[model samples]
Target: MAHTIQGKKQLLTRVRRIKGQAEGLERALNAETECLAILQQIAAIRGAVNGLMAEVLEGHIRTHLGAHDISETQRDNDMEAVVAALRSYLK
Candidate 1:
């Protein structure tokens, strides 16, 4: 992700936070927290993951395709792939 080096620190920070969140979830599981609370944690984790994905996707577009080296067809295909990914992820 040399092209994304500028955002690397921010991305790593987000990942570290996610790791902490995951550890907390594990602790909650070990402590047998309420089912509702566990579900909420899971939802929060999912949202964090989705947010990370969006940032990476944004970087990919701006760094790779933005260089204008690829053909229009290739660019369109890449965008379609991004859309497909989002669709599956949201489902």
Candidate 2:
């Protein structure tokens, strides 16, 4: 995908925050945090990551699937990829 300034900025911010959250989780583990607290943090990180994935998939649908230039086959492939990702993520 071609990089637009806005897309790049948004993705970079999301990825950086996810990285920070992952590091915080590691620190919590290393510090022997309470099981409940650690699990809560892990769950929060997972939600954040999933939300980011959804946002990217939405953009893919709009930019690629909705584009007039793309063929029907390509659009179907994109939708299939999104559905496969959603199923995997939901599992």
The C-alpha stretches of model 1 lying farther than 4 A from their native spots are 71-91
The whole-model lDDT of each prediction reads: 0.86, 0.84
The stretch of ten residues in a row with the least summed lDDT in candidate 2 is 1-10
User: 35, model 1: CA deviation in Å?
Assistant: 0.8
Residue 61 miss distance in model 1 (angstroms): 1.2
- Highest-TM-score candidate: 2
Q: Per-residue lDDT tens digits of candidate 2, residues 1-91?
A: 6533458888888889989999998999999999998999899889889878877877777787788998889889988987898899889
Angstrom error at residue 41, model 1: 0.6
Clashes of 1: 0
Model 2 has an lDDT value of 0.84
Candidate 1: worst-modelled 10 consecutive residues by lDDT? 60-69
